[model samples]
Target: MNEADALVDGEPQFWGGCEIALNTEPLEVIKEILKACGGRLFEIGGVYKLYVGAPGLPVLTMDDGVLRADEAETAKPIRPLDERVNYISGSYTRPEDGWITRVGPPRFDASRISADGRVGADLDVPVVQSGKHFQRLQQQLLNNAAKERRHNLPLPPSAWGVEPGDVLQWTSEHNGYEDKLFEVEHVTDDHSLDSVAAVLEIDHDDYDFDPETDLIEEPDGVLDVDRPAPKEVGSFAVAGVANVGTNNTVRPAVSVSWDDPDDADVTAIRVAYRIAGQVDEPGYAFSYEPAAGQLLIVNLQPATNYEVKAQFESFNGWATETTPWLPVVTPDIRFSQNDFNAAVNARMAQLDTASQAAIATVRDALVNDLTNLAHYLLGQIAKLDDQDQAYQATQGAAVNVVSEEVVTEKQARAAAIQSVEAALDDAAASLIGQIAEVDDKHNALATLFGQVFAENGEGAASALFRLIAHAAPTGVAARIALEAKTAAGAYGEDSAALFLDVIAGVGSVATIKATAFRVQTATGFAPILEVQDDTVKIAGNIGVQGDALVDGSVTASKIAANAVTAEKIAAGAVQAGNIAAGAITANKIQAGTITADRIVTNGITQSDADSGSASGAANGTWRTLCTINIEKDSGTRGVMFLGIISGSLGGSTSQSAADIEGRILRGTSSALFQTSVVATIATGGAFTIPMSVGFRPGSVPNGNHTIRLQVRASIPGGVTIAASGYLYSMLPRA
Candidate 1:
């Protein structure tokens, strides 16, 4: 305890710099006051640590012990910026905001800091830090954070989906095949899409598509009407997709059948399609009924192919043209609505269970018309009350000495409550005139069985088995064998029962002609590709590899690059991504492009600095980036996300417009990446932008960046406006 006589009895006798109080408490009296004082603790955040200790006092608060001053530089002391010693201090068990208040010695408020002599020029660095500089910075940050969560996991097998967004191209022979589009903001429970699983926002340069694993995928370019078609029909059938259907009048019905020496009467049936070598557009060829010397037909796009020759009418009249045969797409059968709803709801819940059983057989024939409409509106409101002695002892009782069957059971319970309020006003006026035919029969059976199997056409999966047997009056092959699945691709693990976040993995091949590519690199879930085995499947979620995920249910704390990881979700939760919908806030969060690996949520209120990484995103203080749940002027806004987030939070590299949410809530794209980090954008607050864009087609892509608004100020400023159709500026850039 005589550490230099406790630093000369804790020095006080004022004046000429002679004091000593290095009681950092121990570690050999703070290594004899850091071998007598120079400096260390470079930087940290959230709590406290400014000890350049021994530089004769800057400020000390050890939870309030005392000694301070640096009032910006109180009388030329000039010292507090060697990495400012790290102190953001908002506290979550202290991340660094410690050493409360201190400015830098009014000559040490009458002196003290020195216990083992020397206290000032003690520099030789190395007071403690080395188990290999923190075990190689925690194994290079957990292997670059599992390679940055498999490099932003949007899943095109974790290589990232092809940049910007929106893609629906098609063509095979005359070139063109396209179909299966979906994305109206990542489905909001497509009838509980049978326990969700599909997320695709991808684009880390689309991993150069090398994919493989087989589904049929072979074809590739050329077929100006059978120039060399036939891609994978031999090795014995079962692997399909030719493309085109609905209204270009049909050609995608291929299955021509040859070897006919006696199957009689049919001539001229040979063909081969799927062209457009690496694309240049125009892949044309027509003829649904016009023929003569050679009607090779055209217009084949969206993944391609063409092969033709149809001129055999015969009844002994004179027709014979046979020479074009070569269409693909054979892979059929797909069933897997969670393994066919666990084998048709385990055989329809062992022959029955979500039990409403038609609301218990129409509530036992409307239980005496709902107990005679509640005794005819409680006896017509107990005949305008007033006699209320419990309706005067069963009221108006004078039926044959006490019972003509209780006066005909109160007139058949007041005529069965006026015939159950006239059968609930005639079944709500026949379901409000079939509410636009039940939204056109669930949008015409989920869009005519999704356009008969979304084009890999053979009359598009027999036109979706003839429009689900002309729109299910009964069962239509148990919901298309529970949304069929055989060629193998779609899957889910439990992203809160999934709509996205298997946390992320996307695969699609859909071919008309030009093929080859099933997904290569970043492989995790057992690499498998080749596709085209009658493609047309796409179903539910699809984040494509904007950066691999499949980990939802949030809980992650700090891991940045783009964002989102802390998953679990459910308190106003509605993520989406790729395009946008980011709003997870108790303090703050705004997602759209955090890429994905684990952002899920389930009621997380914990704020130990939200739990870690992404650089404490500034302790998320009031974290509002793009808020728009559903009512800006009124309020409840959940799962919302407007748009138009132009850009800028004051890094001022210039390029400023910033909007983010004029009105989004239409389902949100993973909370629109937290409106990207709205540096200072305020136009009407609660995040606003989206001016209604319509341009998606092959033009505005390549990550479509934005940032130039350099105004600098100094007398070069002006502001102009016209409003209406458009014309706004802040002039003075001469």
Candidate 2:
């Protein structure tokens, strides 16, 4: 990457990592990375550059000479400002909990809504942690969304100097544009048209964001919702038509049937019903368990009209809206014979009146047609008679021929009248037969009514009503729909099909009690969740949040390998006795979990401790005594350089001293611990000087290091140093 690209690429500013799944498209991964940093990748002059936050400073100014004067007057917008994206929403990983939580754009008074209202786009920065960096990301995204106005500016060849991601200043009087700054999204050259146009969008900068002042609200969560309500009151209908209940006393009733609310929180349903127009009267109410298919509302007045509606109750509160009121009219207790007869008679009379009216209309229309035909025949006869008289005056023999023609025409008119009479007679016969058929049906209905309204209470109608309305006999219980069962099963209640069985509890709160709950997987059955009288066992993976308040000790064998992470254990919660011997190896101990003070002396193994002996003699110049190379793992630790130097101390002059030093070298840095042995005379048999050095390199880079003992004499007399050194490396707590 180029130096400039790397600077704006957010590598140093926002430190994070993302897990890339296999088979993920390279372009998608690149896009997500760029989005996480509020950056954009664009190609300029054959080279690709990734701009992290915003475009660079303005490169040039476009005025009359650089821009096409006439084209600028009709400059077209790349997209209407109102149609550009504004609101942003998406998911990001929360560092504290490692949960992928949804986040919305930061609130800013200057932010604008698109034409369609709250037009939004998702900016998923799943790798971002919940902190100031995440807020800054949101701020940058909002600022980018605010820069929605982009216009296509026609420019001269001189404007070609502006490249993509370059901000440019433009002054125009045509569209009332002042000395406004715009970033060049891209520039297009048309050789054929001899024109160059650049797409310029409003530019954003550091001035648009103020980390200290702007709001950095928490991410969207479940509790952030103001008040959630059910999406729907599912499957509502009124049942039990034409039914009467006589459990304690006879009364008309209807069953309110409905499914559970779509919302899982809704626990029960409340129904209210009263006479349709009795608003001032007290209404009856009934509460049904959640998902109860049906409930009978009894004690209603016979033949009375009522309206009922249902409302749902959730943990949050009651639903804001209720189901629309449904109207129902109770059936009368009895029907008298006189009343039934009168109803049938009234209906029959209506049919008779309609039939008579239709017949009269047809009779009038036929009479008028016959009258018009007679008038036309009369006029024709008079004209023919006049022609016959004129013919007699012209020729006496023709007068007898006219008389014979008139006689033959009169005979044909009589035959036509006979045919019409026969057709009218058939229509009358058909009407009479229909009337007789209707009378026969009416007589049959009267006979049935007699049987139904028989004097005694043991009529076929009463038997039929009881047979249909009363509950079925014991063995045929399956024929009727099963009643809904409750969490506490009640006696005399019918069986029900349950989606989930809650063994105990009242109302909405419930507990699932089971000796063993076996889950079936593709492999086989597994008792993933089991409940005992005082203990619970889970054979599969389980997640626990917050502090685990264990009353009893958790055995080592019960805990799975790697189940308890460094973060999961509280500081100082684990003691030496709590850990089994050899249970924790060097590899198992996290770098910062254990400190020097926390580790017991015996915690250091033989492999980590080393000792060596060296004998050397030197005069004036420093001489190497003993050297040991120790390999250090990448962890926070400290090492001690310890040794004992004993040898003859001799110098050219009396009171001269021999100096011994212990040095620890790692990379380019070293620490030294020095001690001296003084001789009263020029020579001495031997002396011992103990040198110990403690180097607490808090967190040094990992590699092999050398610790050595060196000796030197003050004067030119042989100085001998025999040294035994030891090196111990220890890890410290985080």
Candidate 3:
């Protein structure tokens, strides 16, 4: 047989191995021969050959309608039958398992098999090392098995040759047969005289194949088969509007809810919002996952309407259509500007009323005092007139008598008249001085009250007027009245001037009141007079008619010596400046309530404690360390001294110590009280001794007395005193 036929016949000569007669089929026998040669069998040019490491063979491609075979001869074309296989499936034997066991898990193209049946179930006899490699091999085998037609083409006699592992390409003029490429499975050449041509069996290479490298390139533009398709976005809507804060410029947040597309390709939703009429403001935008379909849009204008929109994105660079713009409005903010103005106006009006009432009270008090003074002066003048009339009558009778004795009597009467006139003149002078004093007081009060309510250029009246204008936009009458009142300094200066004129005897009280208000009657206008009676009554009722008057209108000069009793003064009205030095005796002060705070200086104050320190004494001796001088007035009934004495006493020997004593003494001589003796033996070794003493020295005489803390140790090596010792005295309440 020829060499190609001999190889196909499983000849032992082709492979250097011991071969016995094969009882298997022809294909099986050929496979056995190839296995023995450590190669695979391939059929080419109607002959079978052994192809060792076929995957590692150089690939060939068509060049100018010719096969550019690598390390092989040129390629030739053959007519292929239009045989189509509907289904392609593959199976492989696991290399780890024995050759008898096949891979149980089968892999196949379901769509292809459904249409083509099991005709394409092909066994891929590749020794796959792993399931993954097996799968790849199966895929390739399945693709190859699904080819429509495969042919064994005879090579032209003019060509050098072709090998089983070479690749070839050519075009066929046959109907439906166009340009095609193939891989030469096997090549064969017969050397006998009758055999002239070499034949090649080829499989379709529908995919790009690089023969020189034996690698397949996937078809151009093929997508990543593992990726999923893009999904369309679903509808979204605004949930509700959240309450915005009260600030005008504060941003608001709107809540939104939507359904997730549930698509693998959908990564997130793009959300954006803008105010309804302010689209140009370039509002906010954000992105969120489809799973979290809800979003909060923030930094929006308060009390403003807004529109929101959403869209979905996909893996394939596709964006779904945006959802419709949803309408939403932030909550309305409260506290408008007008409301604030109204509140301010009401407050100012209340304050203005109070200030007016205070001024009226002072004015009326001064007027009442002036009226009382007027009545007194008038009655005194009337008394002087009666005395003058009586003297005139007496003088006339003396003149008519005309004798020596009568003359003498007349001279005596004249002398008496002179004395009486002198007394009257003195009385008049005193009344004039009082009138001047009252006038000064009235001027001083007027200046003070003027400063209190109307001096700062923004007086109570001016402020009230402005507030009234803002509060009552349409109340012209009210606004005009406030304006007029403010212009007149809230009637403060006018009232003060009028009262001053009346008290200075420039005008009568009735005339002054009428002239100030331009009233025809003695009584003032209702608004001015309504408060007059109440305030005048307050002044008039200050003291009983028989009692000496003590009121705000009464100056210090007018008060009699020692007239201001405790019952006559209000609590807290007696300030420090009002009382003379040493005036507040113990009787004047509530006992025990005279705290250290009441004494300004030279008392046991906080600073005294800070500046003082504890002192120690030697054995059998007393040390007068801290001395406090307490001021007691005449009526003081009880005095108490309290403090703590802290120190440590050491004895030279254990049994050499007696006791340490702390005593509180009053004045220079009296030992008011003492703490119980603390045994010095107990404090022998680096220990502290604390003694607390509270002493009441009965009723201390009314004078400045010295109080002392005396410490004595019976026996001591050395005594160390802590610096926390302090003492103070207080008056016990009666």
Candidate 4:
């Protein structure tokens, strides 16, 4: 057991080793059906640790898989992964016949990085590759890697003579240091230190600096260390295989299914899958909530055996139990481009869809809590008010102010007993965490929310509220004091949740997010509202804030509060119920459908006075209420009408036969619409389309909306009915 015995290990265990003649059966014939991608078929009953070679490249059975080693035993015409596909990826070595040639030396990256604490990136990514082929191949691979930025190693760290990023390394006994296994830091003077080294990275942090931090350590000393040879849990087979490709690296994979018998207390299931037959790769760790009982395997090399194991971790008991599962046999796959793209795209989309809805939902939840908070504040104040009055009358009316002060001074302490009578900010955060524990996904978000930008916002709001809360007078001032606390709490809960929701929602997670943002003016900048209560202003117009939705009739960037009309509407159909609900308001009233006992049409003008137009009447320049705006001038501008259509601003512009447009029609009311033509088409800074149509008070005949126009002038080339049309609703009975 000296030098000769030291050269070998594992008791010369051979499971699938033999020299079978090449042909078409259990020899070369059987291999044709047995060889798998990134692997060769080993003899079914004879071998383990066999030596072999595919043309141009040796398809080494460094471990096991190849059934035989005889050249005659190699299969005939089996499809293999293209070697080109493995070039930069180092996925597979390809045979001369376009089959994936077997690859050895997974530790090749070790050579460039272990010389002198320096990773030699300057070392060319070596290959037997030709210049022309490599150039085209490298570019494509680069693009692929670029698209997968998540997988890209961090850009090398920037520093003087060193870096703190991913560097290739290997463990090997160097320079007869008594078999001290040192991490390869760099290749010194182009010398290969050993024929059997495995890659590893340096991970030591030396803190004590003897001379103000410049104690020079030799290169070999920095990495020098002894480690026993790594043990190999030799090749095994996986059972019940499923999906792969969760990662970009090529590896063996198999499906696994198991359950925690004690389901009520479990929190998560952790799985580790790793490729075998290599000395360099590390296994991956993936954890899933107990909720995802099943997981799909991915990133596997076809026909390779991947070792997989799952551990169930329980939240209730804080214990983890492991389960042993079978190995998988990766099958040879030749996928069509379209099929591949389609499958991967669907997988990626699945990752994005759920998150898209989550943001809006969490936002709505915050808003709901805020609203509830207001309701709670009202309840607490009423209770406090009643208490104050009861004590005042019962004790002495003379002590009203003093007694009130005493009550409030004691309120926070007293309220702390009942349901935390803190300010709004505190109340809101309490609710978010309170709600999170109700759902698993919600709780996970809460955990992530805490770890990421800590709800410092809530903390900040609480801080601000406490400042205001503590500053108030003790007695009568307490009521006002508490409100500030409540408001602060509300802001904290709202702002923090909103911030996190926003980041998580972006980046393909959320499809749509709507928020009402108030504009804050920069210091020294003053904005004035020219139109009082204006909802929309010109794009460049200076104002307090812009609209969250689309611009209305104006191109203005901001809108002044309460300026827009209640009569104005967007895409939705205006309903009769809305009139009673207080949403409907107009300067004049014209009853449409009389669904009630009677109808009241106050100041209803004759149909001839109305002018109703559609989108194209003025060639899309029309903005409803554009003319009602006094500041600007438009070609379609005219006198403002309410109860009914009105004639033009000019008396001479009216034509009795001009088409009259119908008013918006309500349910059960079809509207017959028509429009009056432009009295005259004017030049620069002006133009016009004077149109109108009307119906019986509540009976809009078409129930469909139309621009009923009366041509009073040249009526330039009559308009044609469009492919798509518009519809509307009549006014509710008044």
Candidate 5:
């Protein structure tokens, strides 16, 4: 136990380092110091020592007495164990040849050995070529065989020193255990200062009696040398399984999650999947990194159930325990097909709804248009009827006038008839033009209707509507125009006939005059036929009708001078040739009866005179005495303005006499007449001066001409002119 005894009794070791000092008493620091000295502090054979240069090998014999499994000291009853199977069958691929080599027998189940003489479980490991891989397969198969029949040996408090990884030899004559090897796998330490004892749990191990190689036989009694020690087999678990999605063809996605373990030796995670009932067939196997525990399996059959398992691989390419199988199912393809059909039907329904809405809108607008057009046509027809009535009234008036008047009184009536005819012609032409305009409008409306409805699909309905809408106005305008024309023609004919009757009546009057002349010339009597009594007159109506009179039949040579009188002449029958120059003198003619139209050559004269006196007392300033506007006819020959100014100069003396001046101006021209008179009068005396001014504004345009009389006087006192002024203009013939 001392340092010098530990060095003499224990083995000597060499540690290359310099001597150093430490000032800590902690157990960790003591252990670190010893470890730095190339040694470890350990207890062996009830003695503690710092030993180096590797530990002693474990002894694997029953007579050594360091560890033993005695049945009498056991705390639990022993059970009979099943024998483990030997011989493994698997296939491996040689990387150089790319060929699979199968080793061992196919069928080797020990459970069936009693029935069919099969001795071991024929386990299969596929695609294993490397020596390390083969060794892993062999160890896994042996572990499986050992696990089938495991023995749990419990040790009492007396064996409290026994620890895990320690090998023990069991010796018991009654339970048929002689020289069987077991390793302590677990131990329960209950031996505190007050506790009674501890318990040791052990599992069977294949071991050997050799002093150098500590090998063991398998459970089925096959002594295999160089067997690997039992290792703690740990596996990553499949924590979660999920179905991500599926395609239209029913291909599914599956993802799995597992623990990473965080072991540097762990390289990857392995996944295997198959249909639920088809485990015998070859399934899918995939490998992924250990950090990524998820896997996705695709292209699975539709509506099919599946199972999956996951495991992890070590850096040595050895697989650990696999997770329990998980169940999944691929989606059905019919669901997707139903969804697609629903979408298509929904879209079609939307389009149909939109189309029906559009059709309804168009139909409503078309109906409104038709209603408006119908109303318009009715209005036009009403207007045409009014025009027709007006035309009829005009025609009736023209016709009545023609039928009521007599031809003997038609001399004055003839001119009235001509005027009426002219008016009727103008009215008829206007009515006709209006009717034509209506016809054009109707045609335009029809064309518009055709164009508007032609674009619609309802052709028959549109055509019927067009015809119905236009028929009334078209007929009404045409009928009115026809009636107006007929009335106009009748009125014209009646008027012409009436005019001829008047002409004939004038001829009859001439004949009557000629007969009188002939009677007077033949009998040499003043009266052709004298009446003796007042009642000696014809009772029947007298009528004189003829078309013409002979040229010399009614001459003066055939009649008495006073026989032909005013009463015998027709109103419009007398011409210039029928009267002598002096026959109708001015005194004999009626006053104002000869208008300007009857006097063709003599132009008109307008004259005005004023007699009021006007005076201006201021010197050297003109005063307008009077103003007159003379209307000169077009082609007026001359204008004359005359004034007789009479006034007295109040302050006229010999030294300073008063001078008065007068002037006449036309329009804006210079003085047409200017005169000045100087007189000397001590006491105011009257002076009279006559002024005459005339202008021949040659060929004066038709307008009113103005004349003004103005006078100015010298200083001290001014002269005044009595308003005896006259302005006149005479228009001569052009």
Candidate 6:
């Protein structure tokens, strides 16, 4: 086939231009060119080819009959079903600044983001210079990455010609897939089964992205928060008292007018004022308005001076520095309508007299100036007419002389060109001879280099062949030898610069015999790994096999939190000493695992306590002061009740004794488990009783028992009794 003719027929009709470095790899240049044009590079029939845009319409159908049923599952997803690739971010060359910049924000699919937020991808398209083009590429990549659903369809012998990158449509009611377009990503031919299987991916074109219509422009300018101050102030003054409120009340105010800042982002004008020479003491009065140009700083003191300034406020949270202070003083007194009228009339009378005098002076000057101009014009016109007549007589002779000079100049130009051509020919001959001589010298140098660099010869071994080695056998005088003959130097290397890429042959270990060995990074070289005695130490992370650790070798300090599982530790291996104090919280213990046996001796398994007042008890009748219910364990032995009761036996006559008693009762039964009679009141005076009672209900059922502290007075009239206390249920050691 004619190569040129084939290219014209097969290649794209449109032409495009690109720039690349001369020293760039051919494959890299090809890859960049393809990426810039939204194309893919592929190999077919042993020849590389380029295809642009999405694959063509489906040419094959993957219906139920074309799929294999033997496999347990046919439809699969390349990525997790919940993981979405909605956002695509990368860097591209910005044409405006000739620098690599982000392609605006990431191109995103809002629908996918709403469904699943794990959507992110980065695709570097360095060759794409236009921001719009870079945005389009990002959208395309996002769409491609979103096709996570894949299907492996096994086909019969009839479907043999399908290849990767071929577009196909699939319809499977079982998997709920309709007539969906899919791109073939991989194919495997089963020779034993006489069948072919293809891995198909959902095509990106179905997502729908148009480069021309759906483009996003790169944003520009400083952020709205960074807006600058307004450029100019129009006016700042103390206007006369005026009605400046909704009630039409008169008030002294300062008027400030400023030009709006040029920035479109400027959202408001901030005006501030302070008493003159007292800005730092009281600070400034700051107020902002949505509009610019003018503002009224009202409610100021009459006859007072103020220093006012204004600045700009952006829509976001940022304000410019205040402008220079503008000084203004309020009027001493409010000017009434009569005062304004009288002042205006006086100024008008003075201006009217001055205007009439100026008009008379202007009328006299015009008449004098017009007469002088007519005389000067008549004298100058006669002189110009005589000069024009003399010039007309000499015009013909001057034209003839100019024509002769043109012919003579043309003849001299032809002679100069002939001489220049002869000199150029001689120079060309000399240049060719010099070029030949240079070529001869270059060839001689090339031969010398070839001989010096030859692999096997009396010529020295080049640095290219053996990176660090002696060149020829001129001994130590000419070339440096790197081999360590006796390990004698301080660094242990035979040569000063023999430490890079040194190789010990198979069945031997290459040792870095220096105090430290460093690896190179972009910034410089630093030791990342070190050998200390029998152990290896790494500055960064190091991976080791699971079996590499010895039994019980990893201490608590070396272990990460939650790194050790139950399977990792042998049963009964963890002792009490191995656990840290408070390391095991209530949530860490499994429910129902802390039985009564696990509790310590005299643990006080359950307790309930309350403190309150009690009163309104009839003589010889009990009033419950506080009640506590304990759902104790079977091993609970007894409960302890302790508190103080203090109150006056009121309604008792002088010298009349009143007996008071405190008792602890179980449930609502009248039988008292414990009782004390320690209060004796001689009169209606105040009395204090210290009550400490303990109860042991020998045969009481274990679950949920109510205990109460009741107090009563043995006086004739109803006596008041008040108490406060606590209840504790203790368990004995097993």
TM-score: which candidate is best? 2
Worst 10 residues of 4 by lDDT: 148-157
Clashing pairs in 5: 108-120, 109-120, 206-216, 207-215, 207-216, 208-215
Candidate 5 residue spans exceeding 4 A from truth: 1-604, 653-658, 668-683, 697-702, 717-734
Ranking 1 against 2 by TM-score, winner: 2
Per-residue lDDT of candidate 3, residues 561-639 (tens digit): 7675544443344577765699768786665655554433432322111113454545555666577876666334345
Ranking by lDDT: 6, 2, 3, 5, 4, 1
Clashing residue pairs for model 6: none
Give per-residue CA lDDT, model 4, range 1-734, as digits (tens). 12112211232111122234566265553342222111223232243322211111211112111112221211112212231122232222222324333222211123222422222111122222222222222333322222210111111112111111213222113212222112221211112211211212122221111222332222221223354332212222235443434443233345545542435555556666666544555465554555544555666666666667666655544545455544556765544465566666664454345233333333344445444534544565567767866777887767765876776656653454243333443443432211111222222211211111112222422322110111212221111111112333453333322221122223212221112223322222333212224353332333232244354645435545544433322212234643446544563444552233232332222112222332333222222321111111122111222212212222222222232222322222232332323222111111222121222332333222223222222222333211111122123121
How would you order the candidates by TM-score, starting with the best?
2, 6, 3, 5, 4, 1
- Local error of candidate 2 at 257, Å? 78
lDDT top scorer: 6
TM-score to native of every candidate shown? 0.13, 0.27, 0.18, 0.15, 0.18, 0.26
Q: Write the per-residue lDDT of candidate 2 for residues 300-341, one digit (tens) a residue.
A: 677778888877767666445688888888766554465467
Question: For model 3, which pairs clash?
Answer: 44-186, 45-199, 45-200, 58-211, 59-211, 59-212, 60-211
Model 2 poorest 10 in a row by lDDT: 445-454
lDDT of each: 0.25, 0.51, 0.44, 0.31, 0.42, 0.53
Model 4: residues with Cα > 4 Å off, grouped in runs: 1-333, 336-342, 397-401, 407-734
Q: Please provide, for model 6 over 208-271, each residue's C-alpha lDDT reduced to its tens digit, 9 standing for 90 to 100.
A: 5454568666675332333444444344333434435433335677777765455655666667
lDDT for 494 (candidate 3):
33
Off-target runs (Cα >4 Å) in candidate 2 are 1-15, 69-82, 99-116, 190-195, 205-207, 219-734
